[model samples]
Target: MDSSNWAEHLKQDFSKIRLRMLEKLEEFSILRLNPKHFYSIKVEQESSLSPLAELASINLESARMLHIKPYVVSQKSLHEIEKAIKKAKPNVTINSKDNELICSIPEPTAEIREEKIKSSKQVVEEARIALRTKRQDLLKKFKNWYPSENELHSNKNSLEKEISRYLSEIESEWTNKEKEFRQLK
Candidate 1:
């Protein structure tokens, strides 16, 4: 089952055999192959004879047709063959953005939020109170360092600065979004 000698041994018209193989092959996996899919692959006998190969060979009137090659898949080389099969198959998406996790991850829902409650309601309520007390303590500490008017103006200025910073980030994000949208079309 030497693959190298197959071209000489294959006496049938390549075009006619290919046409019949495409039309008569019942298996989705085999029928999906086009001549483009056969490129660079060498045909060899599959363990002397398999029923599918025998049928394919008979339909094509060539024993050499039974000598179809496997893609020589190994753990290391399987990805390449899988990629080629995916390309040959219809409606297959390999690492496509439309179905990717990054694009399709659902927004966290109320059910997910409720699952985070592991403690008693009283304990959670106390914890919330404690956190509020700590925040108030920090605010009081800041107040001691500045007059109330100065602190109020300082907070407003800080908020304006933060808003400007966020606006810049959003502008850059929108620009990238537009470019991505255009490329998709």
Candidate 2:
């Protein structure tokens, strides 16, 4: 590997780290009533169980309400959706009205919000660890290429800067998510 390639290489790695961080952040359910969460359930079809998201359109009717309307509205489909949602989220209130299932998500308790905040902090800590690991990998690789103490120290400083920047980014993301979680009703 050429010495000049470090910048580009680390840039790509940081991008991947950032992407993974964002993906993990999306799993913070307390932050919002994400429609994607409902898609994870499987509803019974004619012969087999299929992804509910594939058969129906999940719309966020409000912050705490979800309207799941199947493409082909029928008693069978409606029952299947209600069953699936109940199975996955027992606390959710399912009401069949018109041609859609109106799901009312229960409000999270104070303890639940605290638990989610703790988990979010853990995720941020994990991302920081991952960044440190990447920094170490770069330092090991630079060992074979760097010729003098000056170049070695220069690269270490660069890695530290990247780490600091990413840590800040992770913290900021978590802080914003925490605010959202606190606002949940």
Top candidate on TM-score is 2
> How close to the true structure is residue 22 of candidate 1, measured as C-alpha lDDT?
29
Q: lDDT per model, in order?
A: 0.33, 0.82
> How large is the C-alpha RMSD of every model relative to the true structure?
26.8, 1.9
What is candidate 1's CA lDDT for residue 178?
Answer: 35
Query: Candidate 1 — worst ten consecutive residues by lDDT sum?
Result: 97-106
Which digits, one per residue and each the tens of the lDDT, describe model 1 over residues 1-185? 12233223222222333333323321222212223223433222333322222222211212112122223434323334334434444332223222111101122244532332222223334433443343344345445554678764675455345434433543454344334323321
lDDT of 1 at 27: 25
lDDT of 2 by residue, 83-157 (tens): 999998777788999999998867888898788888877877888888788788888988888979999889878
TM-score (C-alpha, index-matched) for candidate 2: 0.90
Whose lDDT is greatest here? 2
